[model samples]
Target: MSFRSAVMAEKEESTVEMEETNTNSRAEDEELADGKEDGLEQEEVECANLEEGGGDGDEDEDDDDDDEDQIDNESKKKTDQDKGKKCVPGIVYLGHIPPRLRPKNLRIMLGAYGEIGRIFLQPEDHSVTRKKRKAGNNGKNFIEGWVEFRDKRVAKRVAASLHNTPMTNRKRSQFISDLWSLKYLHRFQWCHLSERLAYEQTVYHQRMRTEISQAKRETNFYLASVEKSQTLDRLRKKKQKKGEAVQDKSWDFTQRRTEDEMRLEKMKKKGLSKKNLQKAQEKSKAIQEKAQSNVSLLAKIFSSGRSKD
Candidate 1:
């Protein structure tokens, strides 16, 4: 009985210790789960705060962009106003452009004096260009040019100072020996040159159209004449084949007397009446008949004398 009681007590003590250990382990698991939930919640809050901060930062960036745009617009307006106050551009005419001297080189040389606006270089004639191309000369040649300067006084000064002077002082320059033939055009604008060029092109086109029209008319007239002649020839050939006489439809009109001959005739008839002019013509005819009859009778007499001999 004593042995059985002791075994029962040991079994009881082991079961209680196991139960206490399971309870402690269960509590620790619950506490860890609670801590994990709280950490997840805190993480969510931090993410929300970060997202809100990012949105605010984006708004701030947008605001900065808007401010910059406004500042840029104000600066552009100020620049425009300043530009409106600037002087009108001046034009300079180049009578002759040296070979190998281009607009870029010209600008580089003249840019030291003042600001350049627009540049136009007149190309050589089409015929000259064709000849050059045929000769394998690919270099472009400018006959004349016009340059716009920002200031009128600067343009005038540049023109005056550069005219009759060497293009450049450098010894190795290609245009070193060439002189500038610049002339500042007073009251001239780029629009004027464009208008002039437009007018010239219009006139050239008009002239070419006129010439072409005239040539076409001449060709049409020549073709018509040739066709008429060919038709006449065919008609003549058909008439000949039919053994018919080709009738001459041409008329011989009486020739009119000149003014001098008419005047002489009028003078001769001035004092003569109709009856008198008729009697004079009759007398001249009778004298011509008598002279002819006398010559015939003398001829007959001479023939008779020759026979008697």
Candidate 2:
């Protein structure tokens, strides 16, 4: 090959390699710029995370205030009760669980730290569309309640010991899945319920707050008794309207029918009327008289029988 041709080929090869080098250098510059931008984005994200964490810390501070208040009230209640005074301790209300906390499970888990005395679970009964069925639906029936160890100090210990442990269980929903449900009751003191009756009475305490409205809060028996009284009033009104009432509301017999009519009316609607109530009164009177007569008779018979023997 000629020397001039070899020189030309060499120049062409060098130029092509220079172009490739330039292209690769440009690509590397772009990659470095991209990495810097990604780092800036990540830094911004980290800053935002810090801000969020700061806000959560504020919320935690607010929660601490509520807990402090609860503990104060419970302490005061115990003091009053210890004085042997008619200690009607004011109840402290705990707001909804922060995230995942079952009051019952938390109470039990916290119980390890203190003695739980009496736990009362009262699910509110919300009014339903069906007047009767609605009347039957109690919220307390849904939200459970419990009494923990009688020792309040232990309860506080459990609260401190179990502090941040995840207390979630299968029953907990996904929304609160991350937060622990088992925590201590801040001001809950332990009290033991003796006998079934006492336990039932204790149910009035530690009820759920479903019907938050003040007017709707009521006990089962209180509401049931009110319903019964209402029914009786309606029945009385019905009898009055029909002119078949046995006695006047004021019990003024002189203004109504004779005693014979009252007896006949009672017979006609024996089941509907309070026949047993009246019959029971009369039966009790008769029984007392008979018992007195029997006592006298027995005494006489004893004397005579002994004489005869």
The most accurate candidate by TM-score is 1
TM-scores vs. true structure, each candidate: 0.56, 0.21
Clashes of each: 0, 31
Cα deviation of 244 in candidate 2 (Å)? Answer: 42
lDDT of each: 0.91, 0.60
Model 1 bad stretches (over 4 Å)? 1-85, 135-138, 247-259, 265-309
lDDT of 2 at 169: 51
Tens digit per residue, CA lDDT, model 1, 195-218: 999998999899999999999999
lDDT of 1 at 135: 98
Error of 1 at 181 (Å): 0.7
| lDDT value, residue 232 of candidate 1 | 93
Measured on C-alpha atoms, candidate 2 has an lDDT of 0.60
lDDT of 2 at 263: 63
- Give the Cα-based TM-score of candidate 2 against the true structure: 0.21
On residues 39-113, what C-alpha lDDT tens digit does candidate 2 reach at each position? 999999999998879988888999999999999999999998888654322212222344234466556654554
